[model samples]
Target: MDVKEGNELKEFNMLYKEVDELYHRIALEIGLSDSAFFILYSIVEFGDGCLQKDIADHYFISRKTINSSIKNLESNGLIELKKGKRRDMHIYLTQAGQKFVEEKMMPVFELENGVFEEFTGEECRQLIQLTKKYVMLCREKIKETYHLSSEDL
Candidate 1:
């Protein structure tokens, strides 16, 4: 690749940084880091309480990072462990966590939605679906670049 190509990729990183900054600001206002809010959001959005390792697997984040985020969420009274038949711990949000998401997170999402209000309803769904697919592809590519297995990831 030429210097021009390299510069374009670097510019892409700047765009990524801008998007991350928006999410970070929205998360901070609710008194939770981006990582913790994502975890709680995923748990509440999905009916099944995810196992610790399962959550790490689905999110493509390091087990250690997930553990640290879980710890922080637990400390903040946003989530709790549900002991059940399985050996792995099932993580769920507390009532306070749900309430916070309802009150705080809903507004944050509203702001984000407003930022993209140019899109129609169908366009919004398609965009979100494509974004998730693109993110998954990027994660898979990163794992391959590192010669790491899915388990290793």
Candidate 2:
């Protein structure tokens, strides 16, 4: 890449890391670990009885990390797990969990919504489209670099 392209890539990476850091700070401010916050956020996004696997896959987190956060949330009385029809566990928010989400998670959702509200519809669409394209291109490059097949990813 040329110098300008390289600098642009660096700027993009810095912005990405900064966004992640902002979320981590929000998690800390709400008295939760970053993983725990994301776990709860996933539950809120996906609904009460979402599967742990689904959360992990959707968030690109490892199952092990999801499991650890699940244990912590359960211990804190924020969530409960029950066996599904297929014998896999489904997570549910407890009564306290519902209250906790109402207090903590909803504001974050609102904040996110508020940010989007500032963007025009076309801008929002372009942002999402470009981001998805960027991710797809990155994944393709990684697979090519490592000689990986689709199944491996």
Which prediction has the highest lDDT against the true structure? 2
TM-score of 1: 0.69
- Candidate 1's residue-wise lDDT over 18-61, tens digit each? 98897788778777877776676667556447777776777666
Top candidate by TM-score: 2
- Candidate 1 minimal-lDDT segment of 10 residues: 40-49
User: Which pairs of residues have clashing backbones in candidate 2?
Assistant: none
Model 2's lDDT to the true fold? 0.93
In model 2, which runs have C-alpha deviations exceeding 4 angstroms? 1-6
Clash count of each predicted structure: 0, 0
Candidate 2 at residue 107, lDDT? 99
lDDT against the true structure, each candidate: 0.77, 0.93
lDDT of 2 by residue, 16-101 (tens): 99999999999999989988999999999999899999988888899999999999999999999999978679999999999999
* Deviation from native of the Cα of residue 108 in model 1, angstroms: 3.1
